[model samples]
Target chain A: MSLISVGEIQAAAQRIRPYVLCTPLIPAPWGDRDRPLFLKPEGLQSVGAFKVRGAFNAIGRLDAATRARGVVAYSSGNHAQAVACAAARFGIVAHIVMPRETPQVKIEATRAHGAEVVLCEPGRREAVAAEVVERTGGVLIPPFDHPDVIAGQGTIGLEIAEDLPEVASVIVPVSGGGLASGIGTAIRALAPAATVFGAEPELAADTAASLAAGHRVDWSIEDRNRTIADGLRSQPSALTFAHLRQVLDGVITVSENEIRDAVREIALRANLVAEPSGAVALAAYRRGATPPGPTVVIVSGGNVELGMLAQILTG
Target chain B: MSLISVGEIQAAAQRIRPYVLCTPLIPAPWGDRDRPLFLKPEGLQSVGAFKVRGAFNAIGRLDAATRARGVVAYSSGNHAQAVACAAARFGIVAHIVMPRETPQVKIEATRAHGAEVVLCEPGRREAVAAEVVERTGGVLIPPFDHPDVIAGQGTIGLEIAEDLPEVASVIVPVSGGGLASGIGTAIRALAPAATVFGAEPELAADTAASLAAGHRVDWSIEDRNRTIADGLRSQPSALTFAHLRQVLDGVITVSENEIRDAVREIALRANLVAEPSGAVALAAYRRGATPPGPTVVIVSGGNVELGMLAQILTG
Candidate 1:
């Protein structure tokens, strides 16, 4: 199997430079004395997630003919919006396959970026996306498994290393593992002294289990859906699992309560909004799951429903 | 009678560049289709407010002999923290006179920055600050009204002009008017076409009343304190009043309900925490108080207490 390399990630950085935002690495006020925590708020991205980086890189690298043929993606959250936004930027047709049970806000946000939305049964998203590609002759932009997508996400690691070379540890939330896989690879290549760890909710800790077992572990969708972190419900793909095994130092799992508290802490202390999934790394850090040093916690996204955020803040 | 000119603001920008953050002008996703709104989040500063600009500028400009003498300031909120943080950076002593009723968090934050805090009665902060200056022989860094402070605040306007040259209007929250005076001077000098407007809480509309009467108008402290925006209780001084009359096009006063709604909107929509006082500019813009244009709303600070932020978000 092919793997994403640092050189490709550097190229991805250059390719998506004009499209994505260079989000600030803010110092969190609540950091411990010895280990200052820096927040990489990817939530500040235009599409409110780091998925935009992978989406833009994957779409931008397509040849002229392939680009004109259009793109299709399967996602129920940030990836859908990222793909839609990136496709809109490239002036290419995009067909997004989202679960019918997806939140109205996510669906609306994806549609707002000028993509045709095709709703499917929760587990049928891939099949639907495949059908769309078969029917429309569109290129499939896999959310995380694709090498180009992983390379794209790795750009964030490049930025972290460039901005804070002394970063001793990086805590990234893992879902399908695109972010962790890419970021881990980049940090390994660019800042070898920095250890990369994956954060996951206990309710959906398939990535942790998979990493520990040294193989991809399948968790029922119903089991994964028990977590409030909707974006992290999916298990890692084979490609992402392979990358994670190589690059990640360990996987840290946080309780749902910890996740909610982290979201609140980020909002209250850092003055930045963090969706539940986006806040997992912070949750892990707050729980003292990571090693001491200048730690970087990736606040992955902020496209949460307002009511949920209000509830978390109030609670 | 000397006024803070744009030249002074430019110089202040250079002086404080090494100290203060060059806050990003983020595009508000909730902006109107016709007139987009941008947020200059000074709350993201190290001190969690734009007060750092003035503090750093005023203190940094001191001669080595004077700097060695230390600095003194009177504030119960962001300014105290700003002064403390700036003084700490310069490795000079900071004497901050705060109201006895100041929150423990603010007091602790100020102390954490190595400032010596002296608590006094609510209305006696100035008197206590004067006593501290006399005792310590430290230079007083007045919260507002001083030329250096105004020049420091104007750096925000210079940044705005540089970032968005086509910016048509700037809406700034008016407290003692240092921020508005500085920003207005910079915008008028740099981006001549951009109109400057001050946002005030209707409950503490001293600046609005003063501007309307074409002179300084005093409001009782009790009357100004009625607003939820605690930082906006002080009336503008003669220096700030003169600058407001010359530089501000108009003042927009927002109701308490509007201010609350604005705080919520900024948190939910923009993913940025904004104190009630800091959110008044966005509140005014949302209420259509300003003329239609590409508006820049200064989110003055994010130094709000967590409990209060929770209440606002939930309510």
Candidate 2:
């Protein structure tokens, strides 16, 4: 399949304009680091994460008949909340099937967005979601595995190009490779001079493995995915892998300690509340994994647990 | 003492324009509040507080001859950091004498901004600051209560008017009347239809008492200042009192527990970090003390101790 193009990203941007924020990119002070760094603060987006872009884009692209059926998603993370938030804009009913083990804060936050949350046993969330679809005729909106979702995410690249103008490199946290591929597609088409790097915690380096193998690779769902960066452990889907291989310049791996440090630094310096997964790009930047252009790091989300934050910032 | 003139506030906006963020005032969507509350995100300012306005304004309005003499202040909190940061922008040397008990983070942050930090015993900070001035030929730049500082703070009022032309009321956290006077003057001049409200924590109600008494009234600096809202214990100065008398339409006070709740709500809903002092406006709003207006609350700062944030967010 052909990769998403600038025109598709442009169209996606237009569709999602009403639902998402043109989140500001703040320039890191010249003295704080060895090189210039700019943060694309997706943490400020609706539902407080970059997932809003793809969620809205996907929702907007849905046919009129399909939207009448409402939407369901299986996620206990930013994606679930993003879909819930975006669906509310269209007055669509959102049913989010989350794991019972999900934090009370996340569940409450998701429900707070007007979504009906169905908490299920961890191993059977998807089955529960499918059962709901069969019962209620709700359309399943998978996170980061569809052409439309990737196209929607590509719009962020368009914004980065417009804001930074001469950005030499862009770093994104890779969970399912959706964000990276989408942003990579836009950069390759609009800002041809810039390189895109995908960041993943070393403990959950499935994306890197998938890239090296030139196919979708799934590690044991529970094996080696034990990093505190909870948002970056998703296995890459075949559709996203195809696009990632076509657009991404490279992937960078970071350790758990590095992710923790980046989160703490952003909180202390930038006055941000970055979840561990949200800080992987900063982790990569701190570890010298960036390719030395006017750099932009995606601050992906800010749903960090207060308990986790205390442990990190007390140091 | 004369009230801060609208002309002075207008001029201060130009003077501190380069040093501070005209922080965004965006629509607020938290819980189920439908009355269109807007957040004046001063917490995003350079030093993570609106105090930068006064600092920058005070520093910028210095006579060229006086600026060459440098400046000094005694603060163990956000005001100290704001002055240090704003003063550094003009290449002026700022000597901040903070209480020795001040958090090391504040000490390092002030030093990082190129300000010379002098730590002294709590009761002796101001005394030490005066001694430094005698040695270094520096002028004392009080954290608030000076004409230039009030004028500088009024620039925030200018921004509030510009950002929310239709605002019905503006609520501000009161440490000193400097912020209130500046904002009240701007609101009275530009948004003539808008009411100005000064907010204070009940635990440190010196400002409220001063306004009632028609003069500066000192509370127990030791006992009255024990609230988690560390920024609102100061009594208004003659300069701010004059402006307060001319411009402020109302004043409200919230309990210390209410301040903590406000801080947590602002963070979870606005995707913004606001310290206890910054949260007093929201606290007032939640307590039904806000006037019948589309209210804009000035989120004053975001410099909470890591331990404190843990306590606030968790409980």
Q: Which lDDT tens digits does candidate 1 get at residues A1-315?
A: 777899999999999998887777887656987779898988877778899999999999999998999999999789999999999989999999999988787899899889999999989999999999999999999988899999999999999999899999999999999999999999999899988999999999998888778788899999999999999998888899889999999999999999999998887667787889999999999877567789999999988877788778778
- Where model 1 places Cα greater than 4 Å from the true spot, the runs are A68-70, A289-292, B100-104, B289-293
Q: What lDDT does candidate 1 reach at residue B179?
A: 92
lDDT of 2 at A235: 76
Q: Model 2: clashing residue pairs?
A: none
Q: Candidate 1, overall lDDT? A: 0.89
Q: What is the C-alpha lDDT of each candidate?
A: 0.89, 0.81
Q: Interface RMSD of every candidate?
A: 2.1, 2.1
Per-residue CA lDDT of candidate 1, range B4-51, in tens? 889999999999987787887787655886678888988878778899
Candidate that would win on TM-score: 1
Candidate 2's TM-score on the B chain: 0.94
TM for every model, in the order presented, reads 0.93, 0.92
